[model samples]
Target: MPSFLGSLRQFVLAPKLSAVTFAERGFPGAGSAAAERLEAIPQAVVCGFEWGIAARDLWEVERRLELVEQEQRGFAYEGAAMAFTVRDAMAGGRGTRTRDLLLGPAAPHLLLAYIGIGFAMARLPRPLWRNIMPDLTGTLFYPTMTWLAVDGYGFDLAYFHPEKYIGKQRVPPPYPWEGRPDYFPRAVDQGIGRALWFTGGAEPETVTASVARFPSERRPDLWSGVGLAATFAGGASADGLARVRDAAGEHWPQLGLGAVFAISARVMAGHVPEHSALACEVLAGSSVDDAVAIAGRTGASPADADDTMPLYEQWRNRIRAELGAISGEQRKAS
Candidate 1:
């Protein structure tokens, strides 16, 4: 049974599973298989969150998540991670539940789980934000990769209020995350880019068109988000992914960088879905191992960088440039 606060959180925050359907969200291609898959992603997150918020023990959360299918189990973990983060934050920093979840069973799903922290960031107050994340300092992707939570916060804003953020292209004021206020909006834009994937029902052209509507300065990050979604959530086929890559044109490197990141996350999670495999081939033009290796070889510690362009951006630029060179070689060969 869920704790009282957990139930309250669920009642107030968790959406009805049916409510996330593409049709309900006013997304295109409501009845398509792609839409169905994309819709299920949010539903899984909600279910995990509901369970995590209410559970009396970590074992309770773990047991419930095990019931989810293997493919979506990571999403469930993501949800639980979000729940724990929110609960811990609300607790005023006395709990280690979020820490335990990530360092323990949830480590493999660290990518999504970290994004889950962003979900907490959205729901909690800014002051409480400090408590939302545990001490993940020495871990892989620590500190720097927490940029993903900013991404997640961006995704939540756009997803929950598309008309305001997505349709209107409203830019949220920047927060001094990771001691870098200037880069905050860019990270959020990347999340918005990810949201565009779902909002467009994974249609390459539709997603690309929506991206074009943004200011040219913003399109590169938007394209990067699109590439991550195309590679990870995958509502399209190989041809569709190819369309996204070509549509990216000058920002193709950003798109491929997103793909490389997606592949790295999936590989790290230890389950590469068939669709992800295809997206990697189409966008990154490489096998899963190579894509993951590319990400691995690109950057390491977030130990150094200027505030305007942090180590995180450095990592992304390196991946983007490497992908660009590879594509250049491919084009020359063809």
Candidate 2:
């Protein structure tokens, strides 16, 4: 009976704990993977935290992460951010990291780290948090990351500061590429679209309503962000995915395609957290196998999943060519 109990214990704990290895990647003595792996640390920590909370048996999951929190604290800003994310997740976003750092001094990469905090926020009961955005003084990826925060934390644009958007109607500072007339507003929409996917709990109408507010030309980019959120963290059902896919319209294939790539990249890194896997499974269905084939077709294997972004860009270019058109091109030509 004791042996059987021990086996049952292992079965219950192993999958949840497995993600910890990914979470631990960037700490000291975690080796070369640490340096190359920092970009993925936020995802790892949040996923690990979420899995632990949602585990079959949650008796000691939070307690087990205490040491991880301490270990993550010892690293630099990213490490600190990861530590804070884990601690906040364990504490259900009531954790003090935001009061200590988010509302105060934070490195630029730390802003990226805050995105992880938002991930934890998405998983917590909505009653636990209200208006978590802090005074973000510097101009980094603040616009993009703020949306990430809103989505992960379940906040509305009303909760976002009005002062930040008071400037001229030009694009926001953190344009992913170059200057565009409405680029900033579009990015904001993308962020809001992402938030809507989370804020509406991944409902198709939420994404649709948010996208409708944007100009028709800008909807696809906004939907791209929506697709990402829906697939990466939405926890949508089959009907939900079908609704999302249908709502995506001309963007559906690309959205589903991107979902596959996102999952495949995680798989390449050897960290198939259940949330991401479920996302891919629901979005791509049988196309997931196709995505795996496409990911490998380039004959390039990134040492880390974070390394796959550029490769994905390359793949996107190839896909666009195969589709016989360019994405986001009509506006540029105009």
Candidate 3:
């Protein structure tokens, strides 16, 4: 049997399994290729962090994030542009089967979950900081990473399976319903742009205003959520915010704060079906008290810990069993 620590390590180091599918399916175009590779980086980072925390080794998460950040910063501007083109192309059609082929059994559910979480997080009230902090920290990271996938690396629509859209090809379908169009593609891009904008040293208000004007179905919700989060966090430094805004505006001004929140929520909630099993296990085993404790340790306020504990315990046991089964299969194969 794998020790908890060993299992955690495996989870963290879980190779870019999704990328293998991308390569196998031959989704042509440089942007498509880049998107495929970029998608893996965040997954690897998140899985590593999740596993490390499970094993009580928090430093690993920091290390992984640092590595990811370095890589993201190093990607060239031209490369990022190519990625965007590919993403847009994929969004139009062409690679639907490629997306399906790569995603296999786990793609649909995972996509829906991400969409749900993103919308949910974006719509959250600003005053609910205590309730939303965990969701913010835990969920936001993934969507933030997705933004990087687009803006930083230029990943395109093929990465998201745009062929699933219904009607005029303008909007993504609603959750659990596969035919709807994605309503917030522009919003997602805008959120990414804003993050880059704020990181660049623009005034927060300027960046905030620019984000407000960017189009999105969830614009009001996203603006409110980001505004609240920024306010609560005391806001980023003016110079820093400007730097981010400058960079984002240069690449994808359409990406906005609300999309970022929504993406993060999706990532945290493990709405992605491929990741659901692991997400469920983590949530089940994790204590609201512990999450609150970790938040306090990180200089954040303590949040309500009463409601999620029972659910956490139940999921943890369920995950333990599932993990055991997977481990057994690995051993047999070996």
Candidate 4:
């Protein structure tokens, strides 16, 4: 007994765009344009908010790590407790239903957030719920929405895994096998096979490639906006903030605006104060080397090293350096 408005919400939120168009096209002003496109694209509007939450969580985790490392006393237990809470919440449910509901209508939105922002965040690899919750919530949300749309509203989109339909359908035997003992059963299997067949040379390749290409293994640029967002959302230490700022500055100068947007969104979401000057400080100046130096000094401790120094930072740095080198060559030629 789903309501019409509920059905409409779910349908409008599903992902539905070609890979070539969404990923490879590289539209001018991709950040702002992409944000607008995402807003307009049905389900994508919620992505920024999800990513903001992730950034905040990661920032909190890093902050706790820094505190445990530095204080080694009363704060250590608190830090551990905080970290455990994030893990537990992620493992169980931290507004998962709400997130699913928000993203239910948009398939591409979920995909893009998972492959693009989620992968970039590296929250998918860890066992902690904080890392895995977004993906799991997204997975459930999309399928449920699809089920509702098809079963309740009579839409014709195919399911992600068609195997679930095997026992639901009955079919006649094929060819001369009609009289054979196994013919009827075999025909049913054949129907299932037909349903599962992919006539196209390959399933549309988007998320897999994006995930594969993720720069999780490298050092991130300090200036990338995700880092900035993480900082303003609170729970990050001064040192963590410095690392994020440095990483963004060193690696993702172009993404500075996006970082600002992320911070703004966090404030708007009520996760942080509305007018924090930290956002402005982090976004100011061309001090990549200085920021990197600060991060090296502050974030070089054992705990920071253990967690791999923020996946977002690693990715931003790697992408920025490569892009910078390419831009350098172009500038040299000019």
For this target, which candidate reaches the highest lDDT against the unseen true structure?
1
For candidate 3, the 10 contiguous residues with the lowest summed lDDT are 149-158
Q: Which candidate number would show the highest TM-score if scored against the true structure? A: 1
TM-score of 3: 0.27
Rank by TM-score, highest first: 1, 2, 3, 4
Candidate 2, lDDT over the whole model: 0.44
184, model 4: CA deviation in Å?
A: 58
**Decoy 2 TM-score against native:** 0.43
Task: Summarize candidate 1's per-residue lDDT along 1-334 as a digit string, tens digits.
Answer: 8778667877987768988788988999999999989988999998999898888889889999988987788888988998898778767878899999999889988989988988888888788876567888778888778899899999989888899988899998888888889999999999999999999999888999999999999999998898888888888987888888889888888888888888888888788999988988888788898888888888846455665587889999888888878878989999
User: For candidate 2, lDDT tens digit of each residue in 249-308?
Assistant: 776545655465455544443444565566665555434555566545532233322422
Total colliding residue pairs, candidate 2: 3
| Full candidate order by lDDT, most accurate first | 1, 2, 3, 4
Q: Is candidate 2 or candidate 4 better by lDDT?
A: 2
Candidate 1 backbone collisions, by pair: none
Query: lDDT of each prediction vs. the true structure?
Result: 0.87, 0.44, 0.30, 0.29
Q: Which has the better TM-score: candidate 1, or candidate 4?
A: 1
Provide the lDDT at 149 for model 2.
Answer: 47
**Model 4 alpha-carbon drift over 4 Å, by segment:** 1-108, 111-223, 226-252, 256-308
User: Where is model 3 more than 4 Å wrong at Cα?
Assistant: 1-21, 30-54, 67-69, 73-162, 165-334
| Tens-digit lDDT string for candidate 3 (1-334) | 3357556544653334454233332333223433344334334433432333233222332343234332221111112122222222333423232232113321222222222223223323323211211122343222222222212111122123323211112332222111112323433442343232222122455445544454544343233323222321222443433343343332221122222222333343233222222222222222233322332232211232233332222222233344344436757999
